[model samples]
Target: MPHPSCARRWAMPKKAKQADLKKLAICVGLGAAIWAIPAPAGVGLPAWRLLGIFLGTIAGIITQPLPLGAVAMMGLGAAQLTGILTFQAAFSAFANEIPWLIAIAFWLSGGFIRSGLGARIAYSIVSVFGKTTLGLTYSLTLAEALLAPAIPSVAARAGGLFLPLAKALCLACGSDPANGTEGKMGSYLMMTCFLSTTISSAMFITAMAANPLAVNLAAETLGYTISWGTWALSALAPGLVCLLLTPALMYVLYPPQVKDTPDAPAKAKEELKRLGPMSRDEKITAFALGLTVCLWIGGQSLGINAVAAALAGLSILLVTNVVTWEQCLSDNQAWDTLTWFAALIAMAAYLNKYGFISWFSDKVVGMVGGLGLSWQAAFGVVTALYFYSHYFFASGAAHIGAMYTAFVSVSIACGTPGIVAALALGQLSNVMGCLTTYGIGSAPPYYGTGYVPQAKWYQFGFIFSVIYLVVWVGVGSAWWKVLGLY
Candidate 1:
């Protein structure tokens, strides 16, 4: 007989396959249900058919019936096979600059981890402000904000850098979930770190994997161009307010039992000492990141495309041997993001091109118009509905794919400014990830630490969701008005 462990491993795949098939059936059922409906007047048959395939693709993304890339590939193949899109059109997004920008940025982000610059920065912050529990949390928040632009994946930053550091800080303070002492400091630290990641993700277009997707969708759906600088500048004020307030709010609401953490700064100092001086690779990575950020900020004025800047930075890293070609190939997340992102962009672009989005937008506008509210009031209602709808979504990318365009359309149709609608919806797309533990890529690992209970997690998630909405809408809107975005 085969070893029991080997037998169990083999059985796991079969069970997973069964579960995947069930989810696949649900996705297919949803597509078929929509596909069977008659195409609306003024919407072509092909556009209607593509909507079904797109919705099914989004379903597959949310339900994870297969790897995201595989599901997207299948969706593209379906679109082509059904004659909704030609072979050339189905694969066209692979050539688009947005997908390549994100993928190249991902590779560039790897330098932070490989060179240990990310950890060094985190440690240096902790060494300064870690004497108090609240201070430690702020240090982590600051570190995260600093790293956000360079690190595209919130999960990688939170899980790989902050989570480990938070756990270490917990142990140093005599707090551990394993010992029923998490409430002392671990719970507060974990919750703050997790919540702050969402804010940092919103602060930059390159901060999260799905952010560029929002940028692409906004441009394609609304004809509102959002450059890297524009996104960063618009978010600067509101994002900073949220970041500064998150630690204090959590401190007040979920106060740590151990307020004075004298050991933390010392621990951080020891960590810094062990890390020693910055290596040559770290210096090179920092220079490359600095050059890239400067370019991203002013490259447009200088006639340098954002994608070109990213490619240039990546090229510098490659030439210096900071990260190898083999390492780039081995980065499954980067490649997978490129694949699904390209597919979704193609589908969404065609949805606009084929006029399905416009038809759907008309229906939504008619419904909202019947309420007879001012456009501001109408936008508020739509924004709230859109923000809270994340309860039904597990992936930000899936949520963006399914709802972002339609909501932006309705907002603009109701007389909301096009840039205002696109940017508001774009920022909320990242902030809304706070609603559930599975809401985004970064939530699970922090929650899985067993520091915060499920009930409290949801409770805090809801509370922060409201807080985020208020800050983004009130403060963000005022700032945008001053900048003449409207």
Candidate 2:
């Protein structure tokens, strides 16, 4: 009481400790609650499986090891146990061409990373652009855009390469990678880097693993073939424009922090220099990745299969001693992702086989009709379904399985552009999944990062979701209409 300053100082540490404890308590409580749920959708698709998703998501948000892939497996097991899904129906994601493609893509990406080619490319970009935060913005966005068309794994695209280097750049720019990023220019930088991967990847047919699946779902289910090249050019134009402008957006979204170091950018450059010359692994990675791109563009006209192209590249990597099978096996995300996608895809096929998704959509259409909305209202309802309907899926491929048929039927009823509607729905699967980091697409790696706080990361995600829903949709609608995709 006699020393006012001492008392004020003394109270701060206790408050800080209490806040940390509170956060821990909240994470634990959420995990427990999710872990304890009853079965969902039925006994096999138990409530606990859904809860496992919740728990896994929570674990990602908190950087905990809650076993997300396990959660997905449990979901499949529930489907089997409860007879909601047959073994073939539940396990087919593993066998599908699409899931295999994604798995293969991850393996290739892993080889590149382990080969040190990824870091070499990253370092090359940084050497050219790491001098300032603004410079870094361009480099980060550009690198991702360039890579988007080739590598389908957004996790590998963003988390493996994008996040690490981007964080290092920010750290070098004197921006703290800690809790204070929100109010600083660094926050905007981080946000933009994260979302840009999603945006740019939206452009190419193979920009994302989901894109091919989405495109195929439309062709097979709706009888239209929107070729790989079309999406690449159409979506890419706007995507590049959006990416180029992200630096400016970040500048406006969060002004430079007063306390941030001015010499941060230079520091990062120096650290990069210390890495010295590129190693053999790095050299192989670059040549292989570059060759992969060349093959992708060239193979399209040469009648080469995309999967075959990937296999060939992977073969080269293994043959050249650029990568080992152990590296491939140790790639937890790659393996786990294949399994995860396979399970969800299997579940999706199951729903289609069982008439569950179509049945549910019929109910929705009937209920939506009862609201007495105008054609525009119907449009909005259908559109909302296109975006928000990802709730029932554990992967983007799964979403298509569950809703592609209904989406096509709705378009037919509304006299909308069938191909456009299909593409829109497919795009929405990605966009909606972006809403929550734990959504079907990017949930795994996102949840596994222990550095960022869950609330904060989610805060970024919510903002990001709104941007995609509002800005991207608005822009994409116009773009699709222009291309007659709408």
Candidate 3:
């Protein structure tokens, strides 16, 4: 590893660094040129100016012209320099509870990873369920669901735990990627690993970094507040069905060549023995996580916000030394997410404040109205299109930033109930990740194993995306209806 002092200098080859700078300059130059065009009829100059910065920021994110946060910071700075937003307004993004909740959850999960609690839990489940090829698939899925709530970073949970275990399981079964034997069982498990995490991410507001961002956006758009309990309760029925059926569906769709793995349980047990007993730090992390869940679920009645519960839990971990201060600070992903999320949140807020979102919504609603479809039909078409549009996006949060508000606004204007519209759109923001190998946080790690080729991954992605949408849309719609969300 390079020294800390020179880490950024040596982070990439010089050629790649220059290429990224070129991409950044092109995005900014094009965005500024676009902003120079005169606004039509009623759109104000500030809204148009802010829109320019927003477009440029999104370009940087998609092209990865810089680290995501750095790109976002440049947008924030641009907004201030152009006088589109005051200093207080731009910095106000950090004051929002949504980003803080996400950041703190990341810190709390660091304790689980650092203390080895998450790995212990995964191995424990594996020992029970690894007796059969089918059982081992379910074991990995269940392990991810258990960890998703506390661990906001799905990439860490899936990559850190599922990736290594999956490789081991596949190799143990003689399904080596290098030998072209991934068709045996490796492909099935790897596909299930990613699909399961996507479902779990939709099931809880704290399950992924983008979920809380969805909640905040829903609030900004429709005055809806999605708490941890509300998000879980809404997703409980369909989410459980999707989780239960995904492994079986993949088993049939992508059948494993090696089926009779009767010795797998013994292998898992042996691995567990090697890990030994859970350490004190592991115990403490588990306890803190459990407590945090309880507080997140119940604290609303006691006048506590979920953000506070997360902070309180993180404090316990810090004080108990379950995770060191340096470990928490060194969580670069969490901090990076915080910066970009804040910047996006600020832009979203200013867009609403400047009437850009509302103005754009009215114009879109008028065109949809011109189609002469009933409100129900219009919304159904829009929602389907929005969910499948993930094929064009590589990040869930960025997709949310670009399309969520306008879609929700259109849905509401088309006479869809606010609560129903908000929850469905919010949930789909995560479920849509099933459409691509690079669509969400956990996608790359699972895809990087090379067990599933690009063509096969996309094929499976389309097939599974349909299954997930049916469960989430059909079954989920019924569940929400029963809850009177509509």
- Index of the highest-lDDT prediction: 1
Candidate achieving the largest TM-score = 2
Model 2 lDDT-worst window of ten: 1-10
lDDT of 1 by residue, 272-352 (tens): 788787888889988887787677656757887667777777788899998788777866656766787678768877876
lDDT of 2 by residue, 48-127 (tens): 44344334333433343333455467556655665545677667767665545555666665555455444444455556
Candidate rank order under lDDT = 1, 3, 2
- C-alpha TM-scores of all predictions: 0.65, 0.67, 0.66
Error in Å for residue 71 of model 1? 1.3
lDDT of all predictions? 0.77, 0.57, 0.73
In model 2, how large is the Cα lDDT of residue 341? 58
**Sequence-dependent TM-score of model 1:** 0.65
Q: What is the total number of backbone clashes in candidate 3?
A: 0
| Over 4 Å off, model 2 | 1-65, 83-90, 96-119, 146-191, 204-277, 295-341, 408-423, 436-459, 476-486
